[model samples]
Target chain A: MSTTTLSKATLSHLDWLEAEAIHIMREVAGQCANPVLLFSGGKDSICMLRVAEKAFRPGRFPFPLMHIDTGHNYKEVTDFRDKRAAELGERLIVRSVEESMARGTVVLKSADESRNKHQSVTLLEAIEEFGFDACIGGARRDEEKARAKERICSFRDEFGQWDPKNQRPELWSLYNARAFKGENIRVFPISNWTEIDVWQYIEREKLELPSIYFAHTRPVVRKAGGMLPVTEITPAKPGDVVEDVLVRFRTVGDITCTAPVESAADTVAKIIEETATTTITERGATRLDDQTSEASMEQRKKEGYF
Target chain B: MSAIENIPAQGNAVDNGLLRFLTCGSVDDGKSTLIGRLLFDTKTILADTLHAIERTSQKRGMEAVDLSLLTDGLQAEREQGITIDVAYRYFTTGTRKYIIADAPGHEQYTRNMVTAASTANLAIILIDARKGVLTQTRRHSYLAHLVNIPHVVVAVNKMDLVDYSQERFEQIKADYLAFAAKLGIDDVRFIPMSALNGDMVVERGERLAWYDGPTLLDILETAPPAHTERAEKFRFPVQYVCRPQDSANPELHDYRGFMGRVESGELAAGDAVTVLPSGLETRVKAIELYGEKLPRATSEQSVTILLEDEIDISRGDMIVKTSELPNVAKQIDAMLCWLSETPLDPRRKYVVRHTTRESKAMLAGIEYRMDINTMERQPAEKLAMNDIARVSLKLAQPLFTDPYVDSRGTGAFIVIDESSNNTVGAGMIL
Candidate 1:
């Protein structure tokens, strides 16, 4: 440790976060018997892939990539998900909500009901099918209130339920990632990262994201205080005010439940600038499913939602 | 109190690295309000978040917008008006960022407080001004001290309740200082604040004319990151071994890397190192961070280390500087905080995960248990949840370790129940 090398001693905030996430990802590879990266082709998942590359790159990732698709997500995201996985040469496992519905494990309340919440069931079924001891996700604490209380290696029951009251007391970077038969651990490598941190990392790494993340012209209808993109599944009804507006998604989720905020920030650098000064939270701005109640996220999480 | 007289009126421009601190107190002490004020004054709270809490406060028929509601993250916590678990909050000043771990004080949640205090470089012990120093204040301070946090900021909150009296602030400061000294807590600072009135938190209000100390934001911003201010022995625990056998690339053919984070101290590319358990000495050939090579790496930065000579090393192995080796032992005497409701069963063999190493440990003896209120050691036959006790463990295999005070990275472990696979206790090596 010379005086000249002292300048490299303290890392920037993004480096610290990237290093931490890489550590967590390696922990999963070192500890878990069977693990899978839950990729949605979203920004957070893309960030996870970059960290996974850093953690075990030159070598293949210890686990494969899996997706629990809702069948109604943005085509750009699903297409990017497949493209990224193929380019990385990693095995990609796609388990669809439609397949779950075909198996009768997931039943829709109505023909037009959103398949957002039912992704949990399909996710659990995929875990059972693959016997994945750990599923690495990209959920961050800063996204919502209940998420802020979750552990880095969030433990779930045999039925994939999260217990909010009783969590493994995580100390230091030591993650308790042990589970029994039929049980699994959902690891959020970027649990400590904020939305702004994610964007800054994306800008630093020059990571690619789906087109919907940036501003684009889309046919959208404003309802319940959220701008829902007009898709075939969620088209504008008779009394709906449809407008071709410039918008970008704050969070990418199911088409029926996820909405986009009005934005013209098209680049990652612009997104970073916008996120730094934005007055709205990531979920509150675009997640229509979160509008029901403050505890809705908690309830969904308890039933094994990532 | 000592640093108060030395601090300038307008504080220094802290251009240091990131700082993580714990703010521990109950709801009544305005701990939430203090945190909320810090976030609000920093302009870190988004409009929708504030609006949501504002709507909730309006529903509850509160007047001043109930800033405390901002910190109530859980549904049950919001209903009961208390922090049930450790909730993380973030904000950034102009120079650096902050990560605040908000842990509860009212409940018998020593495990929660320990979780929050584990990674904190500093701890904020919030004391109600009118009440002076209470039992929980000492308990939380003891927890911070137990974790060996470098700094402690004793915030005398609710100063307005005492008519903004400097005498009241001094009395509480003296009272807390005595306990802090008894608990062997060094680097303690004090400030009088009214979180409800937004005084001496992020701002230097007009009411606190007698008090002259750096605000909480100032201290947090300027505080050095863990293992940065002092030079410590380097400890790198091997988390994973990267051996890529791809025939397509020549670089992947012979690559064998020991991947992990620099848990403490620092390491460079040409440093002499030793692999533990085998006790083999080697020199670092290179330090690979993704595609780039680093001349040196500091604590908390994950990197892949390639040795000059091929030595047998795997996960759970230790890579240390050959000059400063840690103690390797089979028996450990530790201060154990049992975190499970099932209590400790002497007949059960628990797994001790120290660093990356895992070994079976049997409870040898329970020397004594701590009584939180009395601050006394009592003889106990069995250990229960939230009980801090002196316990001896017999490990199935030897582990490379150090005293918890010397380096937290090498001296701490979590006890996992072999049957349930849950973390049963947290132990710090004596």
Candidate 2:
């Protein structure tokens, strides 16, 4: 038998996390028949894309890239999404809430209402149309209280509703990706990663993102202790005063509900420095729709929101 | 050694090492409170979370801010005021990052505790000071050891209720040591703490000056790193086969790579390896990680390896060092932790998933079920949910495996129900 003496290699926590994520991606590809990676051009999804590259490179992904377009999203994010997918030469599938609304599957209370929550209906319809067995997402457990209670391999019913009480037991690395027809599983490979970890990985990997993540001058109105971007979907109220300020988004969602924080951190290094001392979480400081108990994350998750 | 020497000065930058631990005990043993205190003292709790918990406490007609509300995120858990499943909590101090698996303390949730301990490096078993040691405490300790967690911390919580008595703490520690000795656990550390009063959890409470030892935070920071437990031999289970036949990238055509994460030990280029179940020999031609070639791939790194010789390999096949071939057998004697609601029936067939290999298996015979409380072996007919038993299984196909004591990555397997596709039990090869 031939053997070689090699020096040991020490891996950082981020390396371990990346390896675990790649393993999970491979497992999903090996197990699931029809799977799609949900990419929103956000930081988390961008990290997921990088992990997918490491998992299977020089070959096309077994699954396609998908986006649940709310139709109220920021132009920068959607443009970046298209460019990133095109650069990878992978097929991108975009299903919009507008299409669902035209079909009468989604009905908004007001014309100017945020279509973030309504994206779930469109998402479930897309899953039904595509016959996807698994939808890989970038949801982290440390993001919110409800997400923290979710399983890494969260199983969804035929209606795409989540039953947190009846989740399957995920022990060790043996995830049960079994789902009957019409039932899908939402796989979160980065469930163990935190916001800081994501940022650290981004900086280390030199991942590109939309410009809105960095500090930029933009017209915004202050409402509910958060800066709401002034856009056609969300215009200023009667007494609201809009101003230009240097701000950045801690999280990017629909332009109607997502808020920006005042920051001068322009580079990834500066953003890392800012995140280290930040006292407030990403969602608490930014998301407008999460301010009330009625629209709690748990309630939304039960309604098929990712 | 003086306690003050163990306590590092405030605001020291400790290495950002990762530590995963489980907190388990009987219900109402202050397990949740201890985790809450760790997060609160480490300054990981956000201002909004603190305010939310405070408002929830006030609405519930409580005098103090209930820290347990921070972890009990589910609505049903809040309504019942108990953790029914494992809730993972993440926090970081200047020195280290900790992942706490707050396992449910109910007796029936032993499966939950086992799930948490499966990946844990350390375990913090809470023992109520008022109650020296309970049956649940022993059960949690045994589960922790069974999973091969290297470190064990016996936290005597609710010290304030016992008047911060040193004698009481010593008595409990002595009793625990005696019990732990029977399980062959040596790295047990005892600390007296009050999860409510914040004594010796994060800070050194003034009342425990007479009892000199590192605080819970200090001990966690100084505990041994988890990577020291890797197996001594290289073990890699093939997960996927990567072959890109893109015409544009002609350099990659006909490139066959066996992709898998190194489960244990290390593999270097030119090292001879054997593909198990087929027993075919091959030498490592190259180790590629994301388009970059490396001299070696160590444990826990996912990489693609090209062999010198063409061999028949697929998913569920094992590629290990030729010198360290593991047991390839069809019959396995192992310890089983039944996890499903339905009891294990020896007459029925179940799918055994070992590493990436899946095969049909059935229980040959159950040797005995150990009573967790008394450590007694009792003859059991069927293994119920949360029951631990030593049994023999006959597999439809041979598997390459190591004993659970030798390598955790290669030794453990899960039993899945064929009809429901639910994981019904976990086994460790003896």
Candidate 3:
């Protein structure tokens, strides 16, 4: 083939996905005045950071990095988050669920209750404190059923509640990131990507991820039809079955709700290979929070959960 | 089929391009079944997801897997069991990756179809083989043509209901082509299939032997990607200016780069360019992608460009080759689609956001409003929900744009309601 034909055919799926993501990031920067990117030290957010770097480099990012800590997350991921922010020399803001609890905002029914849902409260409080008009997240539409219907630039009320039925009409590449005084827009740059696509981009970009994503022989308790990662906050009960099985985390979230799956994939290549043949979805195989009900994510999202 | 089922660990869909298309039809037309068949045949649905849907189906005492359960449950209320929003689904075949924008077709939901049609390269207008071409068919075809989708495939669904007759399929094809030609749609393909029985979707089942053409998946794999089908007129809109004056780093001083996407065409070093609205001309200094100097910048690549001459340019400015200049006008005539519940108040001023430029525009005049069902252009004073009208707009600032047909990136815009801060309308330059 001629060089022109080769160039035309060279724009692979990953290239198209990366360009679309960068375009979305730049749109948020151009439209919103004060925005912050919600970064968790997971594989998805790691890929998102690389996209942000590609979007605005040689200069600093247009927005700061913020994390709504559940206060029950793995220490390794949080440590990586801090280190990555320090290396980039960008501002990092962390507001915890503990802070919200002390402020009488987040209330738990039991002492051992999961703090994952309360992250929304801390996130909204942080948004109010920082006066941010847009909050860029690494939420993908393919992750769960509820996110599939969300727009690229999602609108939130003053209470941070999302009205799924009444979303703005996003047309062509022209995004509507405008919001009123107390309202905000949740901008998702990677909404079009899937699990394997994220893995492909990470492998192609050679991005670094948290170590917990790789397989390791870790002790875990089996519950919620998933292997719950044994942690200080949520330890195994007397009658609970515990095993030191080799596993890897598909999604790295709050330790109280995030679980690991039985896997031997220690590298990105192996993980991609495992993902292609696996019958379970990323969330279905791991996420302990989603086992409650089908409408739970939608209900929580309506109440300002990310 | 076995080869597709066993997806390879390496080199998965890297050699092929991506196809983004939308499926348009009502629930009665078996639209959901067709989408489900595509995902199922390609093995995109995992075991856990299929199991969940199977349980839901069994609970309702229905036989077999309820394929509609794959969609229609997210964000949309189940009062009518109809999906209202445009839910996007992704699946990959060995040859190409697909992004299916599942949109509903009711007169009140015209905005959803327009939103999906805007980004789609092709549209699958599903027609029930028994009912032939209905008003909904015409609406979808018209909107697809209006959005300038390059290829449209009219899938005559429910062939099993019509006993897989070639005469019925040909009759429906004839009806659709007659309607398509009226709307100036030149590139349309027809397929006969039964999504429930799995005929002609992925595999040519035993029934459709009389027809000899590419399957739906076959046609989508060869469809051109977005920018290749359009005219190559280089139009770059300057989004933001990057000036990193880090005194700590000596090499970063006095560095100013124009940050934006290459909306169309391509650019190389030493190409003479002009900054619009200022009319200042300069040469391309360098194109930087993550601090790496690139030899050329093509369409849709978001990069920073440094000009040889230090001209005063900021956001809302257009960068184009002096050879090919777009029309710089303060007054634009467009076909605008009303997307909001609030009617258009002609006396009020709205914000016209086109490319990177934002201008205050007024509803100067409404030439005619399109009745979506009847396909008639009627005189109207105001536009309500799902209304398309040819209107005259006077802008507070000049926007350099081309017709939407010729250049999608530089020609489309959105109107914002100032009081509510809502995107109320979508406009395409005429």
Candidate 4:
């Protein structure tokens, strides 16, 4: 490449966003004492992995990767998650809602209940377990109303709750990751990156992602104006017709709650093009749990959900 | 597909994924109202939040539910119906996610707006149709441009005030275009809407049938976010020096890595680079991300770099590709936007924190004051709050830098009043 080729190189907005995200990841690694990357094996987390690689590839990262499992995860995602972590030769730590429940730290009203909200208990326990001062996440502002209210370095109380009212005043690019004991900071590296940015970056970087992100023929049943996968965990109800449809997940959450959207855009490039004309916000299209009054994002963040 | 029974009840290693964004505009322009509408319409508001807005609106004797009440959370702000602090509101869409920094619209709060927009990829600039392009609008636009925010959405609000006329929208659009061109803002988008009546905001407006474009929500969801990586000049300001103190980890103990984020450009191991301020030279031996080593590091990625030689470097100094070195200087001229409540005193000295470096700056001389409304420049001796003027400054030490327009990460700095310890002004290198 020519040295003075400022405009010649094929550098898109997505590339810049990825580079910025990677930089943020490195900053977290360099600045924080005990940093752990929160990886859910979702598209956003997949994008964060690419950033982490770009930020620190030839060597191992300073911190290990962690996940707060809601016990109701998709088999495809969890299978791909373990395989990818093993392939990279990186440490992957997991804390489960099932364990939290067993320990009596998390209580449920029903045995067949959605364990999505209970993941917060496991997350706080994991934070305390590792003494993690900074937990890097792939939560995008464009995803949820409460995530939008978050600062890049969101401060959480000792109890792992987010008080939006008591956020630190972030001036310029000077981020104060400083916190007292037991109070960890949730650092969002790609906080500024939109959903489209994540997809585009994924495509441009040729990052490896799980098959669940792409469109596939799946047996699903329509419920709550969305398609819920006909899994045993969230089986088809009576009077519901299970049909095979080409669908893709805009976001990957608990298998029982995250719905799939009807899409033929199987490739990353196709997803990018489809994302360009998408009118419905990403969260609006795929989350079965988010379609209700009880599982609002703002409330989730306040209650210590990522 | 693996059967749910066959699938292990495994939660994949949790990765923290989140997003962030910023919103800007003046008070009367309905900036806060737009945020309120987004939160309200999206069903993100809780019963307590609704009750609070209702109580506040009722206290103010409003007929309808005041949506702006959701964002204007300060006592003085609610009383005066103005946003003073940067009110952050979070909401999510189905396809993706977001973080909205609702910044103050008043000219005096430009510094606060700058602080908010500094880290934002997209900026939504609200424009009141009745007022067209006001001085505050220009200042906001200029700040957006100056800060190098990749996208700008000109939400021309209060369309109902002008009877939702396309002609008025076109005129205001033209006026903004003319002014924006001077500042070199390329991706300027104009969206005309009545934030109050829900026109072209969340939903399409029937009145704007002549105009065909996606709603504000549509644009926000679809607009290309600013790209982060590409072939560009590599600029890294050392923020820390990482060397393990433990002798047991021999490899880590002697590992001397200069850590910083690539402000712009791609860098590879073995790329010849130079240290700024000292003008020393070195080549990248290795790049570290966490404990892993990388062959390359690009713009915006934060990583520690090991050099071929042990060069004298610290937190304030910068590392750049030797081929693209910035000019080093002690004296410089820049456009200053006074941000303090206290007036500017030429004799008073303050610290200028630029990039990752800080230096004591003395006011050398004032050149001219900028008339934001008329876009005119006039000679001035002193600047008060919200005043934009060209000023010459002499630094206590020579610094390596570039013009703000050329390199945003390296060219910008903020003036801190040593007495009150508040950031008094922000400046762009000229």
Query: DockQ, in order, for the candidates?
Result: 0.48, 0.45, 0.62, 0.08
Stretches of candidate 4 exceeding 4 Å from the true structure? A1-10, A169-174, A214-219, A236-247, A262-280, B1-24, B27-112, B119-129, B132-234, B239-273, B276-279, B283-316, B321-407, B411-430
- In Å, residue B397's CA in model 1 sits off its true spot by 0.7
Error of 4 at B227 (Å): 13
* Candidate 1 chain A least-lDDT 10 residues: A1-10
- Taking the tens digit of each residue's C-alpha lDDT, what string does model 2 give over A56-130? 985678899999999988899999999999999889999999999999999999888779999999999999999
Docking outcome class, model 1? acceptable
* Cα lDDT computed for each candidate against the true fold: 0.87, 0.85, 0.87, 0.74
Docking quality category of candidate 4 according to DockQ thresholds: incorrect
Local error of candidate 4 at residue A228 (angstroms): 3.0
Fnat, model by model in order, equals: 0.61, 0.44, 0.63, 0.13
Poorest 10 consecutive residues of model 1 chain B by lDDT?
A: B2-11
* Strongest candidate by TM-score: 3
lDDT by residue for model 1 (B1-430), tens: 2211211111123334467889988888889999999888888787888898889898999886888888888778777766789998887765666789999986589999999988898999898898989988988888888888889899999999999999998989888888778888879999899988888888888999987888887888677776447678889999999999899999888899899988888898889999999999989999887767788877888889999998999999999999999999899999999999999999989999999999999999999998877789999988999999999999999999989998888999999998889999999999
Q: Which residue runs of candidate 3 sit more than 4 Å off their true CA positions?
A: A1-9, B1-14, B227-230
Winner by lDDT between candidate 2 and candidate 1: 1
TM-score to native of every candidate shown: 0.96, 0.95, 0.97, 0.66
**Superposed model 1: Cα runs more than 4 Å off:** A1-9, B1-15
Per-residue C-alpha lDDT of model 3 across residues A1-306, encoded as one tens digit per residue = 111111434556776777788889988998899999998888888888888888888889999999999888888899999999999898999989999999999999998889999999999999999999999999999988889888999999999999888888888889989998889999999999998889877787777888889998999987656787777887888898878999999899988878889999999988887887788999899877787888888989999998
Candidate with more favorable, higher TM-score: 2 or 4: 2
Which is the better candidate, 2 or 3, if ranked by TM-score? Answer: 3
